[model samples]
Target: MRRPDVALVAWGLLGTVAASLALAVAGQLPFGLVVLDVGIALAIAAPIALRLLGVVIPDVLVTATLLAAAGGVVVAHTALAARLAPRDLPLLHFAAALVIALVFMPGQAWLRAATNRLVLRRSRHQQAALQAFLHTLSPELGTLECCRRALAELVRVRQVPGAAIILRDGEAIAHGDFDLAPLVHVWPRGAAADALPARSFGTIELRALPLALREALVRAHVTLGAGPILSPRRRWGHLFLNTGMLGGFFHEDDVEGFQAFVAQLALLLDGADLLARTVAVERSLAHAEKLAALGELAARIAHEIRNPVTAARSLAQQLSREPGLPWVAEHRLILEELERVERRVGELLRFARRDELRFEPVDLGELARATLDALRPRLDAAGIAAGLEASPGVVARADRDKLRQVLVNLLENARDALATSPSPRRVTVAVRNGEGVATLSVTDNGPGAPAEVLSRLFEPFFSTKQTGTGLGLAIARHAVEAHGGAIVAAPAEGAGLAFRVTLPLAETP
Candidate 1:
């Protein structure tokens, strides 16, 4: 710091010596005048010396300081050269030097501000950081790696106490000289807590944090501030930074610059999230299409084999009924096996068919009552207390037999679910009509399906049971969809599963 001041002072002195020598060579001034001129030049150069040493001065202060220095120089020079005649006195040179000093003061202030801005704005380090960040943020970059690179680049270029953070969804990554363990460990807690400031980006206090995190910051001798990285659509995460080393606080400009960087990062996060979701959706659509193709093939194969299976079953039945036949016992077993295959083939046919519906206005209340009555024997045998509730006037447009098949399938499934339950076994069926739709729900107090099983509950050939052919719910779905309705299964309010079927209502005539 002192080196620049020394050099500036030496240069000023050399200029003074050269001026003295030039005056002597020209024979324009006596020794007394030369001395006065040199003294004034040095006095006028005082502010320039201060500037060279990197001091920021307000315009008003600069003007006042320079004016004082100039006035002092003029007074001293006049008092020292008082013996010279008034006309011969070098007052003109002193006055000219004072004017230059006054001009230099304001000019230096403006020049300093401009130069600082140019240096900061066009800094090669910041540019390099941006380029590195772009290179790392290419489409090929993984989402987590992009976040990590962003943090690393910001921390490296900014040269603070090593601070950068990014969080997308629930995952987070951080970079800096300070260990991120404190923040990383607390992320789930921090993210879930509602105390985070609502500001988009700014310094946020961490005083209310957990003991371990606050202690970690204190031990590292750093004061931390949190800034939320957010786009207009979503908030990515909080960026925690310690802007200075040795626990120094951040200035307002530091906060603003950090916010700008955070905003850029938030956009990147948003793009990454959108890209991931797009890829997932595309994969899901492709999978669904593949499943549809498979189903069509299965239905075609089932249709072609139906005639053959029926012919074989007929031949086996004839063989079993043969009068005193030697192979009667073997033929009976074959006939039984044929019956099982026929039942399985029937299920496959029902699930694979997407046939057009035959909608008809049918009373759902009477249907619900009939279904419960038909299943009463099975429910009583399984020790399941079953009851049904159907609004008297509820009606719907559905294939009566198909809708009855759906209700029968759902009730049988519910009864099977409750068969072995150790808990209280009770099944309740409810039917209601409102808002232009009739809803039928079968709820059972049995062990409910888990999340993993619930996800594929309605998928064809996907079932949690050991002996299930996995087509009952699938067939039920087809039956309900054919009636222009929806069927959904979810865990009931208590520890049970509830299957709700909604069908569009037909006005009672």
Candidate 2:
């Protein structure tokens, strides 16, 4: 022992002996009573002395000492009572009971409190660790960022060298100087591990793991300690700590605190996910509102321009008929340009005006066939083969004109898409009914649009053609939605674009 420790021990023993002798002499107690009193004093002083020397006494040892001292006191009191007269026995017994109540009980309480304070010293900082972790949760940070920051905070609070968070999707965010890849590869999988409650794995437990996992952990110099981050709905991820190269382990208090922290982290992650989805929905709603306002503005502009364009076209036609006016070809070109403007204005008006649906049971198969027949001449002129594949009695609850307009727009769109394709180009319109829905698909053999272009196909005023108003698909979508249906575009089976429209099937009588 060091000189200071030895000197302190000597002084402690001397002081204890001096106090015991003083109690025996001053109280005139018998030798046996004096020894009993010395024993009791030592039981009470031992803990205080050890604490002063910075020694942490366990709760079990403290409890055992208190119980032993309490029993010894009772025995000493009984022996003293035996030496007393019969009349004084009851009074001595009463005094002994009072001493037990006033001393042993309170001493036990105090010692337990002191021992817990020493043994669970690290646990006292759990609140601080949690506060630090909570501070990392900021609205400006994303889920992954929050996770990384939380892991960083954990490393700091737990005094571990490194930590990592492995998400359910195999995405890992690591903080600290540790090899996370090997740990990730050896991470326990299957439902068993997922369903496990929060727990710690010490050095022996880690070494006892499967050969591959143990080898990986040993190679990476990481201590295997993890807690699952789970939610009522699904498993979020796992939190891992690298205790150190010495294969350290977590204390019971540390494990409990970690479990609480991970639980809080799981809640935050769930909230972050929910917030992201809500933000996306909000953005979609904002975009829709903007588009609605723009459509209204376009409608007003088209209304104002339509009147002047009509008057100009009428004047041009009249002058052309009167004679070879000085510039007849110029007049023809002016008339053609005016007609294009009028056509665009008409489309804009149709798009803006929400007409009441004239719902009726319409045969989708017949509609497909009729649309194909009406456009067959144009398809033939363009050397594009058009065919209809219809299922008998395939019908939908729709407005015939609106539904027909959708089909015409799709067919025309398909025809235009095939304008530059090689010979033997084909456009197939298929109509089928199943599961209380009618599906109409117009597919063609042509160069399909890229993914970037495909995403914006339904947006207002978004067109691939140079002279196209870009309102065709938009109008089609609006009409279909009015009838409580939907329209979608995708790449065709071989090479081209496919437009599919789904509408509710007509109810049977």
Candidate 3:
């Protein structure tokens, strides 16, 4: 558009015309004049018509006219006086014109191609930078605010105008200038039409924008492309971008760069996800340490407190017996309540104590049955039928008392769960020997633990039960761990909660 540039292009074209005219006149006057006149006239006419009559006239028309004029001049000059003709001059001129045209053709093509390659190379560099940034960012920045700022910086560096990122949990933490109503409103149509795939990130064509919105977008010159931010489990969510006239309307380079951006972004997202998991794991370990400390302290305190509780209960009983007191029954109830308090305190002390186990060879099958027998009265009271599937003489290396306590706690929890369900409550305790270990499962026909609770089931003081101190499972976990085994909760395939306890089998002497 600059005057000097325009003048240079015009001078080159005019020089070609002048050379053709001179060749015609010097060799054969009439024929040369006709060819020159026609070409020159058309060359001058085309641009004026283009300005006034618009682009309907093809560029090919001008090129063709010039070629014809040059050819005509050559032929006329060749036919004239042979000696004066410089016989090969006309052919040389024509060949030269053709060679010039061919050279310029390739030059223009090379320039165009080079421009495209430059864009692609720059895009790749930008993408690489993004990947590097994300890899470092995930660990250092975990909050949404950090993610948002990082995202904004990425878009800014890429020279994109507007973009939005949606996390897997349906939270759209966004950055840049974008009205999401268009995207939200259009997503159903896009989804119904399979515009976005179920679990992968993808791109939407700018031309694919809804009619009215697309028109408005075009006016704003906003173009968009999207791809998924994938993690191992699933895609986080669709990343929507409005590249607001920069980066030039979704070219091949832009698409490639966007895809590379997503790939790197996904890596960061995965790191963020892993970092989150790590933080959670660390938190859990801290809580467990605290609980273990508390449990140990409680056990020691319980040992100390039991002696006094026993003395107080004995004194209360003697006082009750001695009464011609008006409220003898009430006094007896108080003594009973004192006894119950002692029992609970005993359980807590047991949970906290680090008692060395008396490991001995024992039949797990018989132990399982005895545990069920002790809880039979409670199961009957709760109207829950108890079933046992035992592999007899399955020997285990464990403290018999402690292992039996584990089973009893499991059964009691099952009975409590069954009490809340409708009629026909059922609980099953299954024992089997597999591979190198003995497995015991206590399953009940009741609603399973809620998903949220499942995450913290072994955590101390975390219970959903109204009267639960949240220590039962915590205690059971400790006992199993003490025996060099594991206790885990899983929803039963049948009707209720299933507690699986595993212990290594005793090696034959």
TM-score of each: 0.52, 0.55, 0.50
lDDT of 3 by residue, 54-93 (tens): 2222234344545675566556545543545567666666
In every candidate, how many clashes are there?
Answer: 1, 0, 2
- Please provide, for model 2 over 310-403, each residue's C-alpha lDDT reduced to its tens digit, 9 standing for 90 to 100: 9999998898898546987898899999998999999999888888998999999888888888889999999999988999998899999999
- Provide the global lDDT of candidate 2 against the true structure: 0.77
TM-score, model 3 to reference? 0.50
**Best model per TM-score:** 2
Report per-prediction Cα RMSD to one decimal: 16.0, 15.5, 15.9
Q: Where does the lowest 10-residue lDDT sum fall in candidate 3?
A: 50-59
* CA lDDT, every model vs. true structure: 0.70, 0.77, 0.68
Best by lDDT: 2
lDDT score for residue 401 of model 2: 95
Give the per-residue lDDT digits (tens) of candidate 1, residues 411-491: 889988987897568999899987779999999989999888898898888877786888899889878876889999999
| Prediction 2 TM-score vs. true | 0.55
Ranking by TM-score: 2, 1, 3
Model 2, residue 290: displacement in angstroms?
3.1
